[model samples]
Target: MNSVVELRHLTKVYKSMIALNDVSLSIEQDSIYGLLGRNGAGKTTLMSILTAQNFATSGEVEVFGENPYENARVLKRMCFVRESQKYPEDSKAKHAFANARRFFPHWDQVFAEELIEEFRLPLNTTVKKLSRGQQSAIGVIIGLASRAEITFFDEPYLGFDAVARQTFYDRLIADYAEHPRTVVLSSHLIDEVADLIENVIVIDRGSIIIDDSAEEVRKRAVNIVGDADAIARLVAGREVIHRESLGRVASVTMLGRLSSVDHEYIADANLDLAPVSLQQLIVRTTQEGPVDPSAAATEVRSVQT
Candidate 1:
């Protein structure tokens, strides 16, 4: 498959704070890539650099096989829809669509109009006067209808309700099936988009920590559930990602794919194995260490002293 975007040793810094550190990644063409991580994990910075909205402090970035900075050819083919997108204070949904139509060569005015109605956005109302959900709807419409070859949605569904969010996902998948362009979606709502994404790229504290197919990542770990003692025994020597125990029942997740022999061993041990969800796996990998009880006690003692 062709690469739509490439980053080599990409680094971005702001004064004393490092936003991205030696990050290198290649986004495949015509795939829905999930750029996932916690807040302040360099996802937004990376997206901005890719779309030419922000400059990298060091290293290289290539979009459409060319540097995207000030390059109209590359800019015209990419759309970056972010929660912080700004419009004129007096602009309305119609006004935004008009601007998008002029910028994107493949803009579909008809589809944009349809989406405006579907999202129930008031055409005459000023964008700033609209509710947060309404404002998000406007962005979603443009991002989907623009039909840009590479589209980036940076938490674009912030104020939408569950039903509206579902509609956005359904429409995105349906349209992508027909159009087949590259999409990079950065969202904290990991479980919601798990099925839509074909690949996952996880960033942690300014570095790329996980990059693999959604399926492969899912298979990298397995969850076992059974009697507490048996489950503990099964995970005793493995790299445990997460563990939970309730009464006499326990569940444990560990890294590494299960081989045929391992599967047989599990069956012989009578422990039921289940596939781990993408959200669970991500949380395990990216979560900070458990709270320190001793530190909490020390703070309390200091207050008492």
Candidate 2:
């Protein structure tokens, strides 16, 4: 597949803090990409740079094989739906649709209208007067109906309930099947989108920690459960990601798949194997080091404050 977006040694600094650090990534064309991390992990910063909404502090970024900043040709084919999308105070849903139609070459007014009805957004209500979920619905409608070659959805379902969120996903998948394009979806809800994403790119502490096919990453680890003593023996000397014990049973997740030798050992130990959830792997991979004893009391106090 061709690369639709590329970043090399990308860095973003905010005065005294680093937002992105030497991060490099290549996004394949016509693929559904997931940019996942915690709130402060720089996902928004990277998307802003890719869409030319923000200038990178250093390094290079290319969209559609060209620099995106001020390049109308490249910009015209992209749509960015962010969490904080804003509109004029007096503008209504109808006005937003009208503006979107004027801007996007491939805008589908019919689909937009359908989405408005599906989301139950009041067309005559002022944009500012709409509920948060309605605001998010506006963004989702534009992102889906615009038919941009590359669309970026940065936490665009913030206030959507489960039913509405599922509706968005269903529509997105159906639309994507009919019109294949590069899509980057950034969200903290990992498991919710695990099936929709073709590839996973994890950013932790401003750097790429996990970049691989979702299938490959899923296969890189496995969970084992059985008697506590047998589980410990089976997972001994391995890279344990997570472990939990209840009564005499213990479940453990360890990095790397089971080799033939390891499988034989597990068989001998009589432990049952289970699949690990993507969310669990992400949490374990990104967790910080052990807590400091001196700061433990201080941390508790800070939480209460």
Candidate 3:
């Protein structure tokens, strides 16, 4: 697939702190991508730079093969839905959708109206007076109805309840099926959006760590549960990101795929193997290391017995 956005050795620095460190990646056309990481991990900074909302301290950024800064041609095709969108003091939900229709060339008023009702958002109420979930619903409505070629949702469902959030996801997927576009979703709810995204990009400490298809990233790690000694021996020389033991039973999350022979070995050893979900793998991978070498190399906490 063709790339809709490209970055080469991108870096963003603010005074004494670095927000992005030599980041480089490509966003393919018509794909849903999860821009995931812990807070302060530069996910927002990267999206801000790509959309020309912020400047990169160094390196290059391209959206639709053109610089996004001050480039109306490139900017019009993109829509950025921020977590906390500011509005006019007395503006209502209707006013926001009206403005969105004016800005996004492909905005669908009918779809926007449908979303507004489905989310149960009040059009007459002032935006600021509306509940936080209501405010988030407005953003979700705009993001889905805009139909821009590229849409960036920066934690857009902050205050949505489970049912409301599910509505947003369902609407997004349904709309996207009919009108496929490049979508970069920056979210903390990894498992919630796991199946929605085709690709996953994980950033840690201002740098890109993992960028691959959801299927491939899922195979990056596995949980092996069995005898502590057998697991220690089986996973020896392998990178163990997390481990927990309860008496003699140990469960270790190890990186890398399991070979056919390894599966045989696992079965022979009476070990239970479980696939690590995307959320679990990422949590373990991005964890901060202990200061001591021994602690960092091997950490097996006994939760209970």
Give the top-scoring candidate (TM-score): 3
User: Which ranges of candidate 1 are over 4 A from the true structure?
Assistant: 246-248, 288-305
Global lDDT of each candidate: 0.85, 0.85, 0.88
Clash count (model 1, backbone only):
0
Q: What lDDT tens digits, residue by residue, belong to model 3 across residues 1-305? A: 99999999999999999999998899999999999888999998998888888999999999999999999999889999999999999999999999989999999988988888899999999999999999998888999999999999999899999999899889889989999999999999999999999998889889888888998888777899999988887877767889999999999997776666677778888999899999998888889431222232233332121
Candidate 2 residue lDDT tens string, 183-249: 8999888999999999988888788877888887777668888899877766666567688999999
- Compute the lDDT of residue 108 as modeled in candidate 2: 90
Off by over 4 Å in 3: 288-305
Runs with alpha carbons beyond 4 Å of true place in candidate 2: 246-248, 288-305
Clashes of each: 0, 0, 0
What would the per-residue lDDT of candidate 1 be over residues 1-305, giving only the tens digit for each residue? Answer: 99989999999999999999998899999999999988998999999999999999999999989999999999999999999579987888889888899999999888888788888899899989999999999889999999999999999889999988998999999999998999999998999999999999888888887888887777777788888876666656556768888998888877776656566666776888898888887787778432221221121111010
The Cα error of candidate 2 at residue 262, in Å, is 1.7
TM-score of 1: 0.91
> All predictions: root-mean-square deviation over Cα?
8.5, 8.2, 5.1
* Model 2 lowest lDDT segment of ten: 296-305
Deviation of model 3 at 73, angstroms: 0.6
